[model samples]
Target: MTTITFTVSVLCLLPQSALARWACVRACPAACTCTQEKSCSVLCDRSGLAELPKEFPCEASAISLEKNRLKFLSERAFGTLPSLKSLSLDHNNISFITPGAFKGLSNLLELKMAHNDYISYLHTRAFTGLKKLLRLDLSDCNLFSIPDRIFIEQTALKELLCFQNNFRRIPGAIRGMENLTHIYLERNKIEAVAYNSLLGLGSLRYLNLQENRINVIHDNAFQDLLRLENFYLNDNLLSDLPRLAFRGLARLKMLNLGGNQLTNVSKTWFGDLVELEVLYLDRNQLLNIEEGAFENLTSLITLHLNSNNLSTLPFSVFQPIYFLGHLYLFRNPWECDCSLDWLKQWMESYKLVRDIPCAAPPSLAGLDLSQVVFPAVNGTCVEPAELNLTTASSETTATTENRFNSLISKLLQQELREEMGNGTESLRNDTLLDSEEAQLAAGVGGRWTQSVQSLLCFTLTWLLFGPLHLSDAGFWLYCT
Candidate 1:
């Protein structure tokens, strides 16, 4: 009787143990592959999935649903995936996301929905429970605007990618994300950067606004981004910039302003970028650059001035940048004149100088500026006559005044000698008393005319030697 009872108890224990083992071993979702190499990962990519899978392994930490046909994300679509850390939904046909669609993904760290061009409507509470999310990619979506407060709960987000969209302006959703470090908004239709549009994002370090329709940037637009480092505004329609557009960005390193309509560069635009290392002004309509436009770029390493309308740069523009490494001046209408002699001299100290082609002075046209030998006239550079006049007018007014006075004295002495030679016989016939009375009367009149003459002299001096000085002999009529 005792043996029979023990046999029955063993049989019952065997069935209970088998049932426990069956419950512990979960099955992978249909049409999905599950692996356990490093962690539980599920891949359902390119599977023609029309909707979210009804079940997923509870231990899945990462899932890839790329290249699928998912049209929308229903509420709580991913039911209670507590261990989910990374989810990829790239290259899908997803168009809408209902509220609380990601509510059960409490531990999701990264969410990628890139390449979904039809994703246009995203509820404000679509990402309600993803509080610990770090990176989110919504690129290649045809989104015109992002609902404000969509990321209000994503407090720990670090990188946000919204490139290749139709956004007309920066989304107001990322205003207070203090921990965000990078923002990629390239390839959009953003027109302008309003003042304080990026306020309160103090920890942001990288911002890309390239390949857009941006034309205007308000003053103090980046004032609150004190720790920003890399900024890209290239490939836009920016013809002008506000005085303080990049204020408070002292830590900036790389700045790209290439492929724009900027005709002139201002010194005040980069007054606070003392830590800048690379600057790009290539492919612009730049005709002039202010003196000292790069005076404060002491840490500059690479500079681009290629494909511009510039003929010559100021001598002192690149003098303060001692550590410059690469300088790109190709495809510019460079006039190889004495004004550019300083550039040739400066290039000798660097080993990576690009060949500058001469675009003026038909004799030097098609010649390399570095190889051209500038003729020296009397131990000074032989510049054109018109260039000489420009240099003289740039001098101080005191120097010009002295030169005018010397010329006037010489002319007056010549006139007096000519008059005396022609009237020598007439003067001898006249009485010495007549000459004395005439001298006394002339002296009195001279005092009265002296003040008036001085005023006229100064005015004529400016008209002759000022910026608008004439190059012809017609100006001598004013002196007569």
Candidate 2:
């Protein structure tokens, strides 16, 4: 019977093309479909196979075993397919990968084991021979933690996408990968980042930590990332920022701090970012902003301050940020009084303000602040300035007179010297001779004309430099 079987196997060989087809059909596993062109491709997707197919073409370059019942990867699982460049085992039940499981594929560049819900651990030497690997997708693998040395041999990896995992802190597994450029850790369980969490990854450029439980970051959290540019911290629970939290990120361009619990915009929060162009501070509890909070952001172009608890802003808060193009201030309790008139003028001149509606003071509740006309003199205060005393009681009177004379000489032109002297006599009585001043100001022009010039000068000064302090209330009252 053995001699007859050998005789029949020899007789079954036909033409060369037919013989090659028969050999390929015999080598293909029952659970996979194999096709051959310049290279071989074996597809074993959704095959209900509990283990990898044992047989494939020797020259196969791409193998897809996705959506299978694979549970484990043993040593030398893929037998020395030296030409294999891409292998995908996505959406499998793979729970473990023993040491030397991927020891033979020397040319593999991409290995996707993502969406394997049962994979929570990896052996230290599971990926020992993949020296040329570039992209590894392990996202959504139910991984709470990864062994640190698992990637110690994958030195050529560039992008590591591990989003939507269960990591409670920034992983220390990426210590030696100097070629890494992008890391996606968003939507994870990471609560904080230590000072040196990212110590040696100097080539990292894009880091996304948004939509996590991150609330605390040490001051030196990103000190080593000298080349980092884009950082996303939105949709978190951060309440306050340390003074030097972002001290080393001078190259950062875009920052998203929206949807947090930050109560104030501190002046030092963005002090180190000189190249920042876009800033998102919307949907926070921000009610206060320190003066010069955005002084160093000279490159800022878009600013979002909507949906906050802000009631008023300093007129010169955005003076240092001269190149801003878009400003969002909607959904705030804006007191559309005299303090906002300058912003209204700015909005008219700049033409980039968006939907900034008022939410306070019954009358201006729903009106768009850009269109609302503000009264010029509403809530305007003229406080009498007192001179600081530095001399003895006997010399105090003479010193006060001398100071008053000097101030008058500086404020009055040559033609108004006589009036300035008369004004000083009236001021000695601690009264502004209002009726006489009104008549003199009327000689120059109408009340409205005089008021417009003085107010324009004050407004220009306030816009150019910060707020101004005058030593005399009569400066404003001179027109009234």
Candidate 3:
């Protein structure tokens, strides 16, 4: 009687949560497994099924139907699971999605339909009721175009991946997705970016448009993306960037323009991109950079100008980018001459890296430019006449002073030789005069004695040596 009473009590409480649990377990498909821990999760992948498994739990929160033979998603296919938050239909043969296929999935936040190569058709209202969708991946879909209204009701969508498509132009289809922050459209057949092609994507922050056949970017092509930060346009056929191509992007921080045929860079191409920090312009045919080209890029940090044909650069060309930290100019034909002197000085002063070799002038060929001294590589061009004028004048004055001193020394030596010769001759003549004068003064001792000495010496010197020695003999006689 107690057991019967307990069974009745259990039946009485089966109408609310217990009844729902019992129904979920009974409704699970034979080919699918359902688990109801926090939320009902279904696993129906690789089931060789031709369609979505029948009898899915009504409150299923996550479902995986990947690797199935399902070819189409018909309308209202998943309408019973209004609580579905994640769906994976990848690796299926799905080629079409009929209108309202996911109409009642109001709480769906993530969808993974990637690797569905046969999926070439999508009805306009296929994703109509997914109001809370946040991420969608449709990569490798082989799509030629997307219907503009396919995401009409996905107001909360934030990220989308459409890589490996054949979009020849920027999709103007997703204009109203204002909340989108990331979009990957790489590896497309895009040939041109028409004006206002990406309109209404104001909240977009990261965009990847690399690996395309894009050759022309019309003016104002990126006009509506005001908050965009990172833009990748590498590996394209772009030969030039039209003025105002990126006019509306003020907060952009990084840009990649590598692998193109750009022959020149102009200041007009980077119109007021003040916040840009990193830039890549390598692998191009750039030959010239006009003066003041980087005057507006005040916040630039790293610059890549490698693999170009730049032969020279002006001193003030990089003066505006005061905060620039790294610069790459390798694999270029740099003429190491007078024009590069200032560049050499600046490189040493900033201690910048030298990653390229000189390709001109035989002496500096194949040499690391930073290791070379500019003045030694190319001699100073100062005029020799002006530099040597003072030295030449001083040397001339020195030569004149030495010649005058030599002449004065020679005159003194000649006078000393003549005085020595006169003294020796006078000593011999004075002895003879003294002997004669003693005899004369003893014989006649007065005015007649002096007269006799003077007369005798004057006559003897005149007879022996003419007028040159007579004046000397007269002085000797007077002394005796």
lDDT winner? 1
lDDT of each: 0.82, 0.77, 0.76
Write the residue-wise lDDT of candidate 3 on 1-480 in tens digits.
999999889978776666666666777888888777777788898889897765578878899998888888888787567778999998888998888788778889999999898977677777878889999999889788888777878888899998997777777667767899999999999998877678788899999999999998888778888999999999999988886667767799999999999988887777668899988999988999877778878889999999989987767776687447998898899876656767677778887758768776665787777755543314664222333555577776566445434432433333354456754454344433334333433333234345446456545654565433212444454434
Summarize candidate 1's per-residue lDDT along 15-98 as a digit string, tens digits: 654533332235577888877755678889889999888988777789999999999898899999898999999999998898
Report the CA-based lDDT of candidate 3 relative to the real structure: 0.76
Worst 10 residues of 1 by lDDT: 439-448
Candidate 2 residue spans exceeding 4 A from truth: 1-41, 377-480
The number of residue pairs in model 3 that clash at the backbone is 0
What would the per-residue lDDT of candidate 2 be over residues 333-358, giving only the tens digit for each residue?
88766667667788888887767777
Error of 3 at 379 (Å): 11
TM-score of each: 0.75, 0.70, 0.71
Candidate with the larger lDDT of 1 and 2: 1
TM-score of 1: 0.75
What is the Cα-based lDDT of residue 241 in candidate 2?
A: 80
Candidate 3 weakest lDDT stretch, 10 residues:
440-449
Residue 366 in candidate 1 has what lDDT? 90
The backbone clash count of each candidate, in order, is: 0, 0, 0
